[model samples]
Target: MKEIFEYRALLIELVKRDIKKKYRRSILGILWSMLNPFFTMLIIAMVFSSFFKFAIKNFPVYLLTGQLIFNFYSEATNTAMGSILENASLIKKVYVPKHIFPIARVLSSGVNFILSLPGLVLVILITKAPVKFPIVFSFVPVLYVLFFCFGVGLLLASITVYFRDMFHLYGVLLTAISYLTPLFYPKEIVPEKYMFLIKLNPMVYFVDLFRDMVYYGKMPTLDEHLNCIFIIIISLFVGVVVFNMNKKKFILHI
Candidate 1:
């Protein structure tokens, strides 16, 4: 924590560079960040909502809530996975702690995630979903999801240094993960036999927690809270352990 604090300037600069680079050539710039998810939810709601006839009320808000959380995880981890190799010049030239690279990537995506929240709020208001004062507390689960993404990002960034194929493999894996998560549909719609698989997905817990607070206008159950905590702890522990174990060899691979 102290080391991170000491290097806070570098972290901030890297995050800034990431956001700027992503929008450097675009005319709309950061507006695209919010529009991307908004359009995605709009399209999904138009097509799937009509095709499947989902029973859930205000389905667009439900879809956007899930998209917001899942998209953050996807963008953060995917960008972080390439952080070491993408900044190979800096890695070879400087002595900065390598973990900072991945941390910055995830944080940059986190900024975009927060920026996109107003779009979700707009959808909620348009759909007239029940809003309570407690909705402000949704930040708690968002923080947990951020930590989870950071841990996984660290692990991916470290491993990708050695196994370049992880980049391609993770793309496919993310697609599969998106389907496994109950993004467009409700849990009750899932068959009983396969419900356990959804329960096992860590992303499901984070999404459920967020939806409970934001979309459902209720507090998360104790089990939901415990599941998120367990995943965050285990992910951080393994991420630190794996990154430390492999970081020294990054130079050789990169």
Candidate 2:
């Protein structure tokens, strides 16, 4: 980790490059970061709320909270999966730690996620969703989710170096995960028999944590806090182990 701090300038440059490259050709530029989630929430609320008739109050805020958390995970992991391959030329020419590439990708996505928070606040104000003082500390779960994503991003970045096919497979897997998470629908709508599957998904707990603080305006339960911490620890352990094991061989494969 000291090595990463030593290369902090490089990481910062990489993150800035990523954020710039994402918006380079666009007219709105960084504003799109805020607009994308805002529009997504609007479209989702229109389609699901009107067609499905969810019973939840302030459904747009509910959907936005879940979407923000899940979208960060999806964007971070997907971008991180390609981080190694995308920076192949640099890796070949440099001796920098390969782990930085995925970490940089996750940080860049996190910037975008943070940029989109104002959209959530807008939805909250527009819908008049209950807001409380405790919601100010919502960053606690957000930080956990970020660490969880960084760990998963590391694992994906390492694996994709050897098995390029994993990229395509992950897209399909993410789609399935999106549905399995209660992003667009209410958890109560889920059938009793399938509730176990939802409980087993780590993303469910993360999303629930965000919803509890932001949407429900309450602190996450003790179990919810433990679940987030447990997943963060386990994922980081697996990610670092897999990444270290595979990084030396990356040059050969790439």
Candidate 3:
């Protein structure tokens, strides 16, 4: 931890470089961060609301809230996992804390997620979705997700250094996770027998918390708090332990 703090300036620069590099020559540049999710929500809302017909109210808001949150998780962990490999040359030539690479990737993705928020507001206004709870409260769940994603990233960064196939497997896992999450569908649609599946899905609580604040306009219940705490603890504990164990071996593998 001290090492990471000692080199905090480098971390800040990496984050800034990442954000700039992501949209360097693009015309829209950072605005793509906003439009990407907004356009994605448009396609999803159209397909689901028109053809498949989910009975969700303000379907655009519901879809975007979940999509934006999940997109951050998917993008953060994905980039973080590969960050070590991406900076292989630097690791070989320099002595900066290896942790910064993955951390930087997560922060860069987070910047994109934040930039995308204005698009959410535009959707809400155009759709005339009723705002229920204070939007500030939505950041509560976002904090939970951010930490959870970092933990996952740390763990994956460590693992992928050794087993390259983990990258491919993680992609498949994210696809499965997206389906299991109730992003485009209502919870009631799941059969009673499969209710346990919903409970076991970690993203369920995070998504529901964000939805509650943005779409449902309600405070998260004790159950939500407990679930999020448990998931975060488990993810961080495993991620930190595995990362520590494997970080020493990263240079050889990378």
- Which residue pairs does candidate 2 place in steric collision? none
Q: What tens digits encode model 1's per-residue C-alpha lDDT throughout 160-253? A: 9989999999999999889889899888888999988887788999998998889888988888789899999999999989999999989998
Off by over 4 Å in 2: 51-54
The per-residue C-alpha lDDT of model 3 at residue 133 equals 47
Across residues 1-254, which tens digit of lDDT does each residue of candidate 2 receive?
99899999999999999999999989999988889999999988988887555487778988899999999999999999999999999999989899999999999999999999989988989888889876988998889989998899999999999899999999999998999999878899899999998988899999998888888888877888998999999999999999999999999988
Please list the residue runs of candidate 3 whose C-alpha ends up more than 4 Å from where it truly belongs after superposition.
51-54
Better candidate by lDDT, 1 or 2: 2
Ranking the candidates on lDDT from highest down gives 2, 1, 3
**Candidate 1 Cα lDDT to native:** 0.91
Give the range of the ten consecutive residues with the poorest summed lDDT in model 1: 48-57
Per residue, candidate 3 scores C-alpha lDDT tens digits across 153-195 of 9999998988899999999999988988988888888899998
Q: Residue pairs in steric clash, candidate 1? A: none
